[model samples]
Target chain A: MTALKAIDKTTINIEKIRADFPILSRKVNGKPLIYFDNGATAQKPQQVIDRIDHYYSYENANIHRGVHTLSRDITIGYENARAAIQKHLNAANPCEIIFTKGTTDAINLVASSFSKRFISKGDEIIVSVMEHHSNILPWQQVCEEKEAVLKVIPINDAGELVLDEYNKLLNEKTKIIAIAHVSNTLGTINPIKEIISAAHARNIPVLVDGAQAVPHLKVDVQELDCDFYCFSGHKVFGPTGIGVLYGKEKWLNQIPPYQVGGGTIKTVSFEKTEYADIPLKFEAGTPDIAGTLGLATAIDYINEIGLDAITTYEHELLVYATEKLQKLQGVKILGTAKEKAGVLSFIVEGIHPFDIGTILDQMGIAVRTGHHCTQPLVAYYRVPGTVRVSFAFYNTFEEINVFIKGLEKAIIMLK
Target chain B: MTIEETEQEIIDEFELFDDWMQKYEHLIELGKSLPIIDTKYKTDDKLIKGCQAQVWLHSELKDGKVIYTADSDAIITKGMVALMVRVLSNHTPDEIINAKLDFIDKIGLKQHLSPTRSNGLVSMIKQMKMDALAYKVKRE
Candidate 1:
């Protein structure tokens, strides 16, 4: 239909793209793998795998202090990754991009550091109901420690943030507003630009958790003007244990260092210690050098494919899936926000999501079943959990058909 | 029948199905036929934790044998619970405590269940054995 027409056929060669991921060829339970668990973590392309392999094979060295050739080479690769990420998100400076363990770690860094500087007793911090535990817990910990109040921006029945409620929640005492750019479970692509502008109007900083958004959408941090943006590399076809936190230089300068160690220090003595500049200030200990290189390579892969194409193709998949799932008997699709991304969460009446998930797995389909790390959201829905099928650019129409058939079979067995 | 004999019987029955779908159908039938737990015992305390499905288990000792009744929100998990009950229910506390329930692997159900569901299965077995242990202590 009109949604299908939006897909750019000229840019994406789906068959060729699928070949790049080695795991796509795998078989489970005598059936071909139909991986719909991209929201959990995407399948890595050969380029990223080989990049990591190449790093270990040749460029295996700790970065930024050694005079040796391998160390120098690795340092370049690592810093180049920061630059790639900076460019990817269109941040003002490469120094603003801090490499962390992942989105969880990045959020924790901001929560720990920013709250120490900004949050005080009786202050308020804003977060949405749709945040992953990573986003929620860190702020909650800060709130608990500082005697600050954690205000939640409630969602409507359609799984969207009640903007009116959010506006009401913001006040002079509101220190920061942290929200997800795209909900991992609901696939609701939040109005971050508007949210950021609203917060900025009140002179409040906003941290956008872009873990789910980065993989499927075009994220320009400078354009959004979000104070801080963070995403995990693995969610975007890169290696694990690597993520980027894009913080505005001004905000980063104001916040204290997250951790203090050799790489993160300018001077350290028995009585006095001075931290290094912005990124290295936050980056404590030896980082995941190979993982960062892989991340850079993954970024290269995405750039080559083009985010417009990925967005278009993935949107088509989402539309197709939504239509087909809606047509199925007894199926109720959750998160019907007008603007959505890669995920589709649903439940069949009188059938447990786990049962449906198990049957789908038996048929070689991998769909995440359970609360999807959003317990509060699941609780709000009044269901145990949902069977979530999250797609990537490489996913095809045929796989969707297979998933539909498998789901139908599961419902029949369950019902 | 002996615990091993009962397990073997289940394994033999599962062999009749060629594919997972048929086996699942049979399992759903077993789930449908499982004895429902008494409403009084269906409290949160009786509910098994770590299961994707809500499972409530209740047991009582009669003449030193443990009698177990269980219920599950999901049909497949209900089937799994029923299978466990069939092998362990009406058996002596010591017998139930010592039972390995190898029929799950023998019937190839172990591989079919997802990791979380498998964890749920382990929890079910543990709860059953714990009930047996409680009965053993009570009789002592």
Candidate 2:
């Protein structure tokens, strides 16, 4: 057993932070809710909740088109969100950031646009074996449509991406290489900076699905130099239906719009209408206005609190959780990558992941159990699915203690 | 639905959850209300694959709205379908189109259903929506 290292120092108080989420205080099945499903949408803070409410109450109006006072206020709120995200991601320009529905929509936008322009009959797109379905499926659709080959980079036994294999897969014909910044299934934080650099050498554009990474770490899109970076707002305590896609200006200009609708056009004529610029060119219609406002508020909240503090706090929780969860009999931890972000995927011997999740739920311990949108990765490990306990900064060691005891009881009951 | 309506109707039924032992019985009763599924159509072709509980769903368009006939091998899952039907059954095509049906948070039921069962429920909802879409396209 690797000794659990003392966590990198953190400033935020977990109990104080936990109080901010109303749902965290509630009881489930007579026991307090021990939410461990941060991988699938996290519990929002009071600030985020209030921000959404405030938007609807005070600032509800369609943006971009209206000249009215309410419309201008709403439009400013929406664009301010874009600017906030531009800073949050540390992008080179605010114009580089375009809002979409979520991680899926962002990835699809790139696939639809870039593939329409660049992908041809015999080109290839390389994706890691550990990608979420959202990351894999869009590229797949493009390949199927254009008669391009879709190649996969396999993973090591520990569920980490085999960098050697990824290097081997890259070659002349690979037009695009897309991979997840962090494996949601295994919790393996890939060496994406290196991955991006390697693909760039081959002159292949890279898109990173940062749905898991952005929530846990500070991400600088320019520093990474990845051509495309995408993440969901909901995963980072923001509203659903709002997400950001950071694309290099050069690439975004070359790709066509993913959807054609009311807002995307510039000048409408009977014969042919011109399109708008980079950000507006992609956003098709009356967008999630309130959601964008709320998301911007969320970004502000996260920034004020600081990502360094959040990262250190979650790392401690992960170490504490991993050590305790590993100590129990019949427990086998998956994804022992040297670097990870607070996710503990494990399967109990002689118990199904579904059964484990159900039993834990009865004890008021919430966890995600199943393929987690990464069916290929779960299948690659030769298991049905593992019960995933992903921690956020708000979670505490006391909660982890209760979880360990509840897990013991569950295992005993199943036995 | 308004907060008042939710509060008023939420507790109108026999206790919110009376006895844990009798929970499955309530589920069975809920299952009984599901529109009739044609057994003749029972085959792997109609089976929802991702659910832990076996669910079989079939759909038909009735006067612009999609009517669904669904059944599940698991009793609890049948209750889940019943809950879905309560929220969804008589609603108009437009109403169905508008609702997102936050499956995880609402119903306090994902705890009862496996991820696969949840996925199956999702599939049933999607197929019903598709049936509506087909009806819309045909009308157009």
Candidate 3:
């Protein structure tokens, strides 16, 4: 195993962090809950929950274009949340941040609008095999609609993308390069910096599916120079049905509106109707006001804890888990990439992943099982599915030990 | 023995195990002891869907009794199927069709089965009854 940097224990108070998430203390099936399903969705902190509650309890009002005082206050709060996200992503302007339902929604918006404007028949879109179905299906749909071709970048046995293969697939016909910043199944953090630069050299815009990346890393859209970056709120300890799609202002101005309705228009007459500017042009009708507030608060929570500290703590935890799991007999981890995030996928010999997950659940350990929305990747591995354990900064070394004990017991039972 | 009597017997057998580990060990032993289905019977038509594990179930009528043969890729699923076959097979078509097989709940396995596995179990039972009904109609 390659040596990992040791995290400073003083940087993060694990106990205090755990206290922020109330669900961590709950019991499942008479055992203490050991949540290792952060990849699926993270447990919310008290601050985010309270933020949502406070929004509905006091500041509940429809945002934008209202003359009432409550509406003005809510509109300010909602727009402030957008600015917060813009700052978090380090985008040049707050208008570059377009709020959507979630990561899937954000991807669909880009796939539909951008493809309609830029892609023509026989045009090609590049994607990686390691993408979640959200990233794959949208491009597939656009390809089908536009009669364009979808090219997939293959992966190595270690779950890292074959950069040579990716370069070979890219050509003059390649209109856009859509890929995941991190594989939710393999936890391989793709070199998005390299990917974006390569695509940019070809003058092809790259859209990064940052659903799994935003939770664990500090994302700077300007630094990566990605055309678009999108992520969900729920995966980062916020409420569901809220996400951000950060697009370059030039690209945003070029792409047409995905959905048209109440708030997304400038002037509507029997004649030609003018659309609203940049961000408002994309956001239509009433949005998830409470969810947006909660997401902003979640971002604030992460900022307070600090992404550097969180990244350090989670990296150490992943290394500890990988080392311990590798030492166990009959256990085979799926992804062995040199660089990875919090996801750990493995299968025990002579034991099915479902059975192992079931046994683990009985012991109050929560781990995701099955294809994890990456069926092609699972099929490539030649397994029905895998047992996935994803960690967050809130998780402790002690919790990992409990998970190891449960997993060992499960293996014995199945064997 | 009657189907109810067989179910009660199986429930009593499960009662001997205290912990989930011991119960699962008994299940693994039962799976190991299950009669293997002929390779020809393991086709796609006999496959049960919605299971996390692939399960193939086949049934035949012999001397007015319905006999079931099944296999699963997962051991626990195989064991569960084996228990079903042990309880429901080698019985009259009418008995096989109508039998409640309440022993799954009595043995504390119902709560333990995952939602998908429970659905698979239901599909397994349904397929056996459908086979019995076919045989019963042919006789009539």
What's every prediction's RMSD, in angstroms?
1.6, 9.2, 2.2
Task: Give the number of the best model, judged by DockQ.
Answer: 1
In terms of lDDT, the poorest run of 10 residues in model 3 chain A is A1-10
Give the TM-score (vs. native) of candidate 1: 0.97
Off by over 4 Å in 1: A1-5, B112-119
> Is candidate 1 or 2 superior in lDDT?
1
| Candidate 1 lDDT by residue in tens digits, B85-140 | 99999999999999987789878887534466533666778889998998889778
Write down the worst ten-residue block by lDDT for model 1 chain B: B111-120
* 2 or 3, greater by lDDT: 3
> Could you give candidate 1's fraction of true interface contacts?
0.68
- The regions of model 3 sitting more than 4 angstroms off are A1-4, A269-272, B91-102, B111-119, B129-140
Give me the candidate number with maximum TM-score: 1
| Docking level of model 1 | medium
Cα lDDT, all candidates: 0.91, 0.80, 0.91
Candidate 2 lDDT, tens digit per residue, A210-320?
A: 999988999999899999999999999888889989999999989999898888989989899899998899999899887787788888877777888887777778877
Among residues 3 or more apart in sequence or in different chains, the pairs in candidate 1 whose N, CA or C atoms overlap within 3 Å are none
